[model samples]
Target chain A: MSEHLPQAVVALDVGGTAVKSLVVDRDGVLHRASTPTRASDGPEQSFAVVLQAVEAALAAVPPTHTAVGVGLAVPGTVDENRGVCVHSENLGWTDLPVRDLVAARTGLPVGFGHDVRAGGLAEWRLGAGRGAEDLAYLSVGTGIAAALVLGGRPVVAGGYVGEVGHGGTTDGDPCACGGRGCPETFASAAAIGRRYTRLTGTPVDGARGVLDRTLQGDRTAELVWAEAVDGLGVLVSDIVRVTGASRVVVGGGLVHAGDALLDPLREHVRRRLTVHRLPEIVPAVLGGTAGAWGSVLLGWRAAGRGDAATVERYAELHRARVTS
Target chain B: MSEHLPQAVVALDVGGTAVKSLVVDRDGVLHRASTPTRASDGPEQSFAVVLQAVEAALAAVPPTHTAVGVGLAVPGTVDENRGVCVHSENLGWTDLPVRDLVAARTGLPVGFGHDVRAGGLAEWRLGAGRGAEDLAYLSVGTGIAAALVLGGRPVVAGGYVGEVGHGGTTDGDPCACGGRGCPETFASAAAIGRRYTRLTGTPVDGARGVLDRTLQGDRTAELVWAEAVDGLGVLVSDIVRVTGASRVVVGGGLVHAGDALLDPLREHVRRRLTVHRLPEIVPAVLGGTAGAWGSVLLGWRAAGRGDAATVERYAELHRARVTS
Candidate 1:
């Protein structure tokens, strides 16, 4: 752990409930920080809390600094080149240039990116898809969305690529995107917990609780899980047809169900596809730190200091390891 | 023409019925030489015939000697990097190393490319899509397929990007791609003629004949034409949903129907799309010679003499025009 201190970059992952902060540098080492988002207090107040967190993290930084860049991974539609969070329903943000605001406050050259896309970048570069060129990252948390990486580059699709949540379904269920029958309405982690609790007389508070009951043969949990996995399969199939991705990385709050959810999804996708090669569906390796690590990488790349900073940190890490 | 006698690329476009050959310099100036394909005689027989035609054209080149490459454009899934014709369903080719064969035979580097994608490249570089970045080239011919160009690079999704013909439909007749209710079942030129002939009992020969009858107020022809337009509209809508491409260039055989198809398609797409921005649908400027010209340009780029070739040809073309 002491060996990881020298080669660190700042990563800030903004979520509705909490803002996760971390320092992950060249060697893939991690030092984490968390603060309440209080999204109801809005972008300005929440942004202040984020700034305070960054200050605290910066205080721990060692002296041999080359340059600093922040990766602010936010939800919703982001105009990445402009560094603006266009719209996030959960954060209630609309046309906010969060990148400029953060940079002005922190005096750090910041790297702004979409949350799901950033998580995918982390997994692809440092985790499950380390060598895979074509992969999809599906995050089934409070809300559902995906980040598709094709030929080693994330498919941005004119800022509308991975809206798997809003890939309007043939089913009849209302989605918060103001659409009827969207994939997120059934496949999301929140949906899994809510749907199971509603179907059965006995309530399960969270996905983990539902998973425990499911292992004990709860009929409601089993049904709800099936529906969620079915939705996931459908969404995955659509992406497969379009992108021809060779690998899929599954993560988020619901992934705690593990092999129970993954095994069935793998079977369904394989059954549905007739023409294309069936992609390997695997669990994402970065776990919870994916977004934060991804943010720092994005920041580094954005600043055009990638090679220089990486080499410097690599040398520092080697020196530290030798000394210790 | 006399002053620039030696400055031309032998552009050979291999199709099902005929092989269209021409000498085109960097300027759009063309000298034509065409012959029957005789594809049923098989690849070796067709190759012998084509070799004679190419030799005849080269012999006609009067002394001024600047031909650097042979540009061959064929209807097929071309492995552009390897310069191989992987498979062309219409041409009955499989694993033909066309570029190497042509280079060895002609003593010049060969630039081979897929006909439709080459046509799209021509349109994008010098025709309707000259100024646009994210555009689509929809070639609605005997078969229906589209080439997607994003950021001036064609989206070849692992060699299967433009297979738009098999795009399944909601309620339609069966298709040849082993899929029930595909877009090509009703939207293709052949389909248009078939539907018109079946409905009216008029025994119209082809798309042109059907269009002529429709113009004469034949009820069944009009209905078939309308349905074809609607099918095109559905395909266009699907492209928008998946790609978010804002500019589309339409070409191929059916497009010769002109405003009869375009006006109706424009109206249908506008009426159907409630949320997303309606893309500007327009016609391609490069007519029959798009593929050949684009292939020549590709050859010029490959040889590292593109700029010099363009300048020399521009000067020669200007001189020719002045002398004429």
Candidate 2:
């Protein structure tokens, strides 16, 4: 271990269930750690967990890897310009100066952003959307939303843009967002599982179980899955028409289903389009680590060291890590 | 015209039936003219008409005004970068090098763009959307489309963006774009008129007739209008959610109905929105002349003379002319 090595950064993706932390150097990831968020304990305890997670990541940094900055990707409505977490329905955070608090504890500059946006940034810069000037990253996890990247820059419209989840898709089921027929109500991972259970009076693990049941020729499961796919198609078609994004990278738990999800979706959207050019729908290559990698990129950007070549290097390293 | 005077520009708004041209100077519109497009005569004849319209506008420049550039706004799928009118179902233009031809004819630089985008630029820079970084210009004319301006720059995704008209809305009647349930099938001025006619076996002039019938207590007209308003509301609500646009400027023939169109439409969209901030919905002030004024602005921008102050000067002069 030598101090002469190029500086690295600490990255954290804070979720309600767990915090994924990483020490990312120019060569590759130097260390990784995952810790419980303990979000239900209260906002104070959750903040403490965030701080501890960062500390542990920093402690894992090799002597040869000097930490330059820290990046945190949290799930919620965040005001990135002000370094404040405006609100998080999941983590129960409100107006928390997480960036300032983290910076004070670590004595390093902190780049704070929304989790979905961070993941989108990573995908746009390093994964499926690489080289695309206009792209969208649609994450269909517990909830459905999108990260819009236009003109080679991620659109952060006061952190309020990319709420496609709540955009109405039908006039049937009411959404948790207090709207009927929202894309989230039909296509979200949580929604798919809930709908399947509600329709058949049986419990399921998640979207994966529903997808599996559909593949096994369960009529109820097939109907629920088809509904989810149709809803997603409508949402994607709207995004493509509105944004003219050439590429749409699908991520989150639903993407793991691979062609089972993409083939039908591509056909559905293609049929729906009339004047708009058909966008290339693809899977996110970064998997669960995308948010953490996005945090690393954000940290580098915050440190003013995020050149295109540097980003390429990190992306190549991450790809190699996943393959190996 | 004296060469020493401040340079002005020739602007034209080319539509299916007519072309509106203007000689715009520092003091505002120095001269205005209108002529038939003769678009039924085929693409070559229509192109000749465009040239004649430019010549007519250039000829109207006052002795103190020196014409420096020309700008043309045309309906259809325009490739602004390549200066080609990709396709225009209305004007019958396909892959026409409008910019190059106009430039060659006028022996001056030309600025060419989509008609809706030109109107949107005018609204964003000089009309209702002034001072807002994120806004949408929704034109509910023969067809419904939007021009999205984000972060003070119009989102021109290869001229394919803002095709909200073709995005499905209800899965009912087939749209002219070969899609069913598209916004254009339910919300466009043409759709409103056609739906009203089909519902009551009465041929009406246009959307105005439908609105008039609705005000006269016709249940059929009221239902048609209500459906159009609802479709438009869903479209606008989706736009607001996806783009976080702070203001939505409604233009085109439909806006002439004023509060008749705005009041209920606003309420419908407001009710649909859940978490997103409600954007102020207002009518476009520039009216039919917006496209010509926008062409003028584009010409100035192309001539490397466009700045905020220059735009403000032109806008002030235009406002004075309207007031007078």
Candidate 3:
């Protein structure tokens, strides 16, 4: 019966290149808008772009619906409790009072957090990480990062908790990040394409193009793919051992490869583990909408509607809508 | 005033080879006892030996002091909430109702947990992990293992967490655990001695002997030590990335190598990390006594004397008394 209640939220997911804004309710996504984030223009300009995106989302709220609140997610180090963005190398922001700026401008409550963690929160609440007590969502995008949810709470650790891409592992090549053995050098979506092109002297589309070549029985493509799987195996093993993550939700662009990416990586981590519980390695079904969707959660909390029943109601509605 | 009270607890730290028992109060260690564990004789005999050790410890409690409770820490997978030993290959125990049996036998409230985690608790409370909110204590014993403490609480995860010894990483050789890339194959104290003896056809006095040979300009010792350092660097980098461990207390036998082990491992991890916060890599000051000392904390909890004030009093009394 309460499903008939008209309530909505405005949310913005601020990334390095783009800021995705969405208007959402329990029923589903109502409206969406996108804007370029001129991050290199530095904090003030980026701040202006974020505010513009928020305005666009606020405008998309249906007239019949009550605009509950707004949520904002941005890249790099963030302190959610204090509502301050500590640092963002991409956007050139430091100690930016993201929540205060948005709250002051909109005269409404604002929820703020790190983009990847926000994405992981969405998965934990409504998608692949459902029912997992300890879950890790690894986002293998243009830049690789991971997010951890332990005991059903995001392990924020001042937003530096999941930079797996920067760890100097053992087998991978030197990374542009100035690390000699980082897994991102071989496994991240951009790195997969970069390595394949460097090895074959041929430009491919992206990690997707390389996957296509592998299906066609390209030996070099298979080798490159194998290296990526191995790198993921090593990194995932570390995550499992230290965090006891019972479910690993593989998210981001490379997850588009589907079984081709997960199957071998799962097998590799399995063979490497001697006395550890095998976590279910599954694709994050929410795709690119996760961060924005998670912002919806943040919005409801800011609106004082963040009860378990409210979240569960959305879980029943959104999971059916998005996952399907 | 609390320091004048003569109250105590009996505690046991059961390892694969030996069972250490301690009778203690806030002031410091009062009584210590050790017994060989015939773990190969299976669960019944091992259980009998444990009971005998407990009896001995109870007897050692001074006549004037009241023994409040008992704490028992054991190896392998443990469910602390259930007080059950889930599995222990060394002791051939599975589904052993440890707390029930001990409590019924002694008529005392019993506290139970994993041994390595117990040691980590000791460190977090009174040793190198003193001020760290998120800490990892790596025990480089005959078999390498680690224990985690997050948010000032031990990450139990049904005792499957912190098996870094068994993770299939990228640098180390094949281990007896059937993993081709476990850090334990190289970085463990046992592994260090084994590798040194295998290369030079000379037996050493454990890992300590290999350190001595390295000081004497033995090239094989240096090579073996370098491999160990590299392996540890890779594992530690992953730990820092995944867990955001601000303090890593290196415990067990190899920590005796002091700066010889820590200096190179610290530098290696520093080179491997690019963007993460620099964690302090320090030796576990309590050394082999940590697990038994940690058992004291568990004992106090069982006795209804576990509180922040009680723990703080212990910290003030024990750190000064033990650390010196």
Candidate 4:
């Protein structure tokens, strides 16, 4: 009788810019919160930022439900099984036992993993990659990364599996990852904004602004956009060849470019792969909430309520919230 | 008491150049044979060639042993699960049900797979990729291809998984596969031989001959050899970045170059991958026998005598043949 009505969980996606946290139950998210992540201020400050967001989300849980567990999604090389950050360039962390620390502090079970991998899991299980036995989700934000889902599960090769942004040796200039000729240097959403700004000395909103200008026939915007498309084509073509992923889900802020981005990118990949079975390149369906929703899965997993079947139930519940 | 004799299986690796076959029991290979493959003469001739090799191998089986099954390894998009060749450019075949047809003709059960994939399976199970959970086997002969083994098993992906030769968008002229900038145009052993002869108008044995001349300070040989290494470096770097394979097993004819090939190839791969985990690039231990041995595995599988444990038992038997 004292089993505490119904239980919910707190999920946090710790990105470089902000910590997006949510309180969710089997019925879907009831509340959400965001907090600044002082990532450059080091691991301690970032940890604090995460804790603040978690606490706030927990407090916002519906009065009928009690928060039971926590799901933490972070950046960098993570050992999901051990719930440890092997290395995170953004958080300045190494060998940090995030699950144990958060579990101890919150007195709740914890599930932890790489942020991109988490988002990919959500996409694979219930979004764009639902029916795919193998899928590659390419997230093209300020930086590019991929989450490989093979055999209906994410391929987490000790967090080294999907660093295609830094892995690709395609067209480009010097990159922040200490490599030259990286595809993302010329293709990422941020790259479009930066290159366009530098070349034209004209300020635009972001990749979105550049796309708008391109639609309006801005020469600099067209060049920047065209180069981005070509670089992505090389990256995706290489990815299809190497991984044999038949379905490719392109995500992140740049997906807003829609047909303007996908059409030319598809042309580039098709032109390059003459003898290969072409992969289905499509926009990611989950958008920005992927990581946060993926966090819900992690939270449910930590609470011993997650599996393929449970994922369906949550998908049903959350999908109702989304579409309705 | 009447079950007196051990059973052997006939295995055939049908390639564009030849059909190499062997007879093997639980202990190891006992006999081998090869016949020219009339591959360009069309599918029927190729099938006849394969049958001749199989018959020759079965006839060579030890007098005390009974032949039980057959294993066929072919190129192109093979549905190993269905034992059908979806397409083979070399054999000029499409949807050719090799296993079923051979089984009907020989009145025996049969197993089948892609030749390069079978070779990679052998390498992963008992050779260069012995203990690697994920490994990439790159075979460079007249052409180039890769067999990817992930999570201790080969990734079949409906046989579209590893076509890195024509997959890479790199520096090159036009390719035979109707694509521009394919890595194989420069990196394959045939490419090395063809380019050197085209440039110097001097007769050479092959890539091996070019290497010998390069060692003797032949300038044209040096240029050709350098380009091959550079092309391979780009391909391998992209492969490493995209697949996250921590070990690369290089096989086929060019591996004979030893340090001359590996050293410069390693330098190129390193120069390209600035931030990825450097893979252990090594030579394949099996040399040319990998496909035949892998066919032995398929034969055993068809005979209901294969599994992870059976793979171990066969490895033990074959290792004796290899070493002693």
Which is the leading candidate under DockQ? 2
Worst 10 residues of 2 chain A by lDDT: A167-176
Error of 1 at B296 (Å): 2.7
Measured on C-alpha atoms, candidate 1 has an lDDT of 0.71
| Candidate 4, position B9, lDDT | 89
TM-score versus the correct structure, for each prediction: 0.80, 0.95, 0.94, 0.93
Rate residue B196 of model 1 by lDDT. Answer: 76
Q: Between 3 and 4, whose DockQ is larger?
A: 3
Which portion of correct inter-chain contacts appears in model 2?
0.57
Model 2: which residue pairs collide?
A: none
Docking class of 2: medium
Question: Per-model C-alpha lDDT, please?
Answer: 0.71, 0.87, 0.85, 0.83
TM-score of chain A of 3: 0.94
Off by over 4 Å in 3: A1-7, A170-174, B1-7, B169-174
lDDT at B95 for candidate 2? 87
Tens digits of per-residue lDDT for model 2, B1-324: 366787888889998888999887765777888999999999888889999889888888777778888989998888788898999988888888989988888899999999999999998888888888789899999888899888777887777878999955436898878888898887899999999889789999889999999889999999999999988898888888888888999999999999999999899888878778789999998999888888988888777777778888866765676578
lDDT of 3 at B288: 85
List model 1 lDDT by residue over A267-313, tens digit each. Answer: 87765454344788988866777787678777777666567557455
Model 2 chain A TM-score equals: 0.95
TM-score of 2: 0.95
lDDT of 3 by residue, B1-324 (tens): 534558889999999999999998766678999999999888999999999999899999887677778999999988787899999887788999999999898888888988888999988987889988778898888877888876666777666788888866544577876776677777889999998888888989878988898899999999988888887887787788887778899998889999999999899888778878778999998878889988888888987887777678767776676657
Give interface RMSD, per candidate: 4.1, 1.9, 1.9, 2.1
Which structure among the candidates has the greatest TM-score? 2
Q: Mind giving the per-residue lDDT tens digits that candidate 1 earns over B228-299? A: 888788667556545556788998888888898899988877654533446899987667767766676666
Error of 4 at A158 (Å): 1.9
